[model samples]
Every structure is written in structure tokens, then in C-alpha cells.
Target: MNNADSASQSVQTMYAERFATDLTDNRAEQKELTAQIERLRDRLEQLRTDETWLTGMQAALPGETAPPRPRRAPRTGRKPAETDAPAGTAVPGPRPAGRAKARPSRARTSVKKAVPTAAAPLHQLIRALMPLGEPRLVREVHADLAKAHPERGTSVQVVRNTLETLVKRGVVGKGIQKGTAMYTATAPAASEGDEAPAAG
Candidate 1:
């Protein structure tokens, strides 16, 4: 009877040890699965962020062709001859034989000042009508311009001319509807508030 009792106690102990070992193994597997899940989540987040950045870059650099380079000013120092000057006025005689002609200085004119005729009023009009999603008819534009510049009371012809000029300068786009034309704003106005470049 004493031997049988001792054998039963040893079996119970072995069973408890086996149960403990199985529980420990299960916990280790759970921890490994949790780590793998976290790593996968991190990779998904990284991929989403990368996709967003790629989309922005694609928007910023649309179209296959690169932007055209700005034209450089001519290197010749000669000032344009004053063709409109009256014939009688004593044009300054060429520098005396011994004195060297002074080199013409390069003046850095602000873009706004350079395009004064086209930029200021046009910019004002654009600011007044921002986020212009739809095309505006010539008559409607003229009316808006007149309302904004009541003191000037601009004519339809003038507004049309300005719109055409804006189109040529790439500041505005023209849309045709029913054999008629409409205008739409392009880029933001310049910081110095100049008018858009004039059409030839």
C-alpha cells in the first residue's frame, strides 16, 4: 500500500511539470507572433508614407517635358539709340578722342517694375477673385473690372485687350465656348503686384 501511494504522487508531479512546459511554450509563441505583427504594421505605415510623398512629387513635376530656361540679356553694352529724339537737339558728342567710353552699368530692375503696365491692376483683380475655378466671359470680366476700378471705369475693349495680353504672357488661359471666348486665371500673382507681361 505505501509503494502504490508513492507511485501515484510521482505521476501527479510529472503531469504538473508537463503542463507548465506547454504553457511556457505557448507564451513564447504568442510573444513572437505579437512582434511579427508589430513589424508588419510598421512596414505598412512606411509604405503608405512613401506613396504619399511620391504622389506629391508626381503632382509637382507633371508632364514629360522640362520647363524652358529663361532667356539671358544681351551682352553688348551699347544703350539703345534714342530714335524718337528730335533731330535738332545736340546729341552728346562721342567721348573726346583721349577719354575712354564708360562701360554701361547693369541695372537690376525688379520684375514688378519691369512689367508695370500689365501686373498691378491685373493682380488686384485676381486677388479680388481668388480660387477661380470656372471660366469668365469677357463681358463678365469687364463688368468686374469696372466695379473694382470704378474710378477708372475701364471699357470692355480695354479689358479684352488686357485679357488677350495676359493670355500671351502665360498668366491667364482662354477657353472657347459656343464660338465665344472666356478667360481663366493661371498662377498666383507676383509678390510686387505687377501686371502680367504684355502681349506682342
Candidate 2:
């Protein structure tokens, strides 16, 4: 009778151990599943934002004649050139090479106190800022620029646009890690004395 009692106790102990092990595995699985759900939700939000932007862009595509009605500025070409000078001062990438040379002369005449080194193309600065082989966020790059070279005072949007342009031109590689956009240099990182060779 004592032997039987011992056997029953041992069986109950084994069952208890099994239950604990199963419970631990269930909790771990729940944690993993919860993480996956959060990631999916984040990704879905990103996709929706992209979709809305893409829709707006498609509406403005050249094939759409509706855009021409609001684009009545073609009648005043000189006015646009005068207006775009400020845009050139603000963001250099979109302005044409011919306009670029013309814009800087006016900018230097106006904002002469702005650092000469800051006149270096933002794209060039980005090429200089990026380290080899590691992805970096636009804001991260902008922060370093703001810190190390405060003279090159620029906004996060400008940095982000410049990086995206570089990505399209094959001068930089873009990545999205956990819903954040990042860029890495495709060319060797530029040195203090040297500028990166532009991609064709």
C-alpha cells in the first residue's frame, strides 16, 4: 500500500512538471505572436500612407489634363524664374544646373553672411556625411550635420529629399528597417578633402 502511494505521488509530480513546461511554452508563443501583430500593424499603416501619397501623385501625372487648368503660370515664365531663385536657395537638387550657377550669385549677394562651405551642394554634403556600409536615418544624418557643421543649416525635409534623390540616382542604397527609412553609401565615403564620385 505504501509502494502504491509512492507511485501515485510520482505520477502526479510528473504531470505537474509537464503542465508547467506547457504553460511556459504557451507564454513564450503568446509574446512572439504579440510582437508579430504589432509589426504587421505598423507595416499596414506605412502601406496606407504610401498608397495615399501615390494616389495624389498619380492624379498629377502628365497624362492627366486636369492639372493644366491650375498650372496657369506658364504665361509668366520670368516670374517663375525669379520665384524659383528662393527655392534654389532653399533646396538645390530640383533646380537646373544653369539655374544653379545663376542662383548662387544672387544668394551670396543677399545672404553673404552664410558660410562659404555651406554653399557646397547638399547632395555633396550628404555624400561626405555618409559612412561606408552602414545605413543611417535622414534625421540622424541631419543631426550630425547640424552638430559638426552648424553652418550648413538645413531642415530634415531637405535632407530626406536629397537622400531619396541620391537613392534614385544609385549613389546611395536605401533600406527600411522596422518601418524606418535609412540610407547607406554605395560609393566609398568621401573624405574631408575629397568629394564622392557621382553615379551616372
Candidate 3:
């Protein structure tokens, strides 16, 4: 009876040791698998970031053919002269030789000041002041007109609104002076056919 009891105890110790070793091996394997999963997640995040950056770059850039690239003017043995455009060929680049002084830009052409006889009273008043030959502020123009022509009784706001309208109409030139708007009257150019008759 004593021998049997001792053997049973030894068998129980061996089983406990085997169970502990199996548990340890399983834990190690679990730790290794968890680390591998974390690495994959980090790599996925990096790839997503790169993809987002690439998408943004693509959005900001113009389409490839937006402005057809200007072909390089073919090189010739002799450099062409300013006036030496070869005949019968479309100038192969951005600008053709002697571009007719690019028609004055719209902004320049439109800045024509004319106070016709039938113009609004405010416009006529502003035009009359053009003889001052300098840009004037809205406040200054308003004060002067009020003082000189009491009957007009124009308000400062009226002057400002009128000035803004005149600027849009190209009848008045607007400039910035000392960070404030300054207005100047522009005279319409006389047409070529309307030249004054020569005095005898």
C-alpha cells in the first residue's frame, strides 16, 4: 500500500510539469502572432498615408494637355532676324514676330472719360472737376462740389457711389494713393475721322 501511494504521487507530479510546459509554449506562440499582426497594421497605415498624399498631388496638378507645350522653335544654321519670319509657315511658337502691339488691354482701352451733354448730373459735376488735373478722394470731391454748388446738395455717399459706377463704366480712372482710393477723370480719345479741321 505504501509503494502504490508513492507511485501515484510521482505520476501526478509528471503530469503537472507537462501541463505547465504546454501552457508556456502556447503563450509564446500567441505573443509572436500578436507582434506579427501589429507589424502588418503599421505597414497598412503607411501605405494608406502614401496613397492619400499621391491623390492630393494628382488633384492640384493641371491635366497633362491643358496648355499644349509650345514647341521649341526649330534651330537653324543662321539665327533669324527680328523681322525674318519665314513666309508661308505658322510661327511655330507662342508669339509671332511683331505682334501688333497687343491691342491695349481691355482695362486700358476702357478707361475713357467723357461727360456727354446728356450725362447724369452727378457725372457732369465729376467731369467738371477733371480740369483739376489730379486724382481726388471721394471726400474731397464731395466737399468741393457742395461748397461751390450749394444747389446740388450732393452727399458724400452719393459721391462715392457715383465714383464706383464711373470706375466700372471706364469713364473714370481709379488709383490707390496712400492706401486710399483716388479717382481721376479720363477724356475719351477723338476718333481718327473726327480730327479737327485745319485752320487756314
Candidate 4:
């Protein structure tokens, strides 16, 4: 009976040692897996940071690799007052503070019949063609000029060209309204006081 009891106790001790070894191995495996998961998370965060940096760099570039803007032109050798005048047009000088009044409205048929020599200056003709406190088309100016000076023969192209020149000089404002180019005089007629010295 004593021998049998000793044998049984030995067997129980062996089984306990085996169970402890297995539990230790399981704990080691769990630790290794937790480390691998942490590494994967760090890699994902790094990738996100790199992506954000690349996006910012793209935004900094102008128009996404657009060409550089051209330099501004040098000033002309002409005087500041003559600056308002168009090329090839005769500008006597800068206009006086007080300008001459426009001619009274006349019949368009009579104005059209008038000779070129009798025609009013182009700038004066344009002003007379314009209405108070509103924008007018080049065609409207041409029509009005015909009415005001029947003898004068001003073409529609000529009127448009003159208006563009006026816009560059800053006396007139140009803008697109309803998909059409419209122009208005920046200064009021009362301030203009009748005289438009600049020639067409």
C-alpha cells in the first residue's frame, strides 16, 4: 500500500509541471501578437502624416504648376496728360477744368448730311451721344451722333474704338452686363460742364 501511494504522488507532480509549461507558452504568444499590432498602428499613422504633407505641398504650387505671370510693361515716354490720349489721335493738350457745352440735339437726318469738315470732334460727339446716368452701346452713340450732327459721318467701329480709348483713360467705366459690353461715364455731365477737348 505505501509504494502505491508514492507512485500516485509522482504522477500528480508531473501533470502539474506540464500544465504550467503550457500556460507560460500561451502568455508569450499573446505578448508577441500585441507588439505586432502596435507596430501596424504606428505604420498607419506615419502613412497618414505623409499623405497630409503631400497634399499641402500641392496646394502651395500656383495653379498646380502654372506658368509664371508676365511682367508689366514699361511706361511710355509721353507726358501724364497726353497719357489719356490714344495713339495717332491729335490731342491738343490736357482739357481745361471747365469744358465747352455739347451742341443741342438736332435731327439725325440733318446731322448725317453734314460734311466731315463740319463734324464735331469725336470725344465731344461721343459725350453728346451718351445719356445722363446710364450706360450706352456704341451703336447708340453712333445713332445719337447722327442725330446731333447730320452732316458728320461717324462709323460704328470708330465709335467703339473711341469708347475703348476713353475707358483706358479712366474717364469711362466698362463692364459686362447681360453678356454685353456696357460703358458709363465715371464723371457726371454737370462736372464735365460741356467741354470735351479730347479728339477722336
lDDT by residue for model 1 (1-200), tens = 99999999999999999999999999988985675566556656644443433332332342411111111111222212321232334332222111211211121133223244333465456434533556888778766655554333344566678777777767678889899997887756453255543422
Which digits, one per residue and each the tens of the lDDT, describe model 4 over residues 1-200? Answer: 89999999999999999999999999988985675466556656644443433333332343432111111111222223323342334332212111211211342243344434354467755765576558887767777776665444555676788888777766678888898888888865444434554547
- The regions of model 1 sitting more than 4 angstroms off are 1-131, 191-196
The candidate, 1 or 2, that scores higher on TM-score is: 2
What does the lDDT read for residue 124 in candidate 1? 57
**Clashes per model (N, Cα, C within 3 A):** 7, 0, 1, 14
TM-score of predicted model 3? 0.33
User: 1-200 in candidate 3: lDDT tens per residue?
Assistant: 99999999999999999999999999988985675566556656644443433332332243322121122112221223322443334442224212312432442243232113212356656556654447888878877765554435455676788777766766668999789999887754221112222210
lDDT of each: 0.51, 0.61, 0.52, 0.55
- Cα deviation at 21, candidate 1, in Å, is 99
Task: List runs of model 3 lying over 4 Å from the truth.
Answer: 1-120, 188-200
Candidate 4 ranges beyond 4 A from true positions: 1-119, 189-199
- lDDT for predicted candidate 2 compared with the true structure: 0.61
Clashing pairs in 2: none
Measured on C-alpha atoms, candidate 3 has an lDDT of 0.52
Q: Relative to the unseen true structure, what is the Cα RMSD of model 1? A: 27.6
What is the Cα-based lDDT of residue 15 in candidate 2? 100
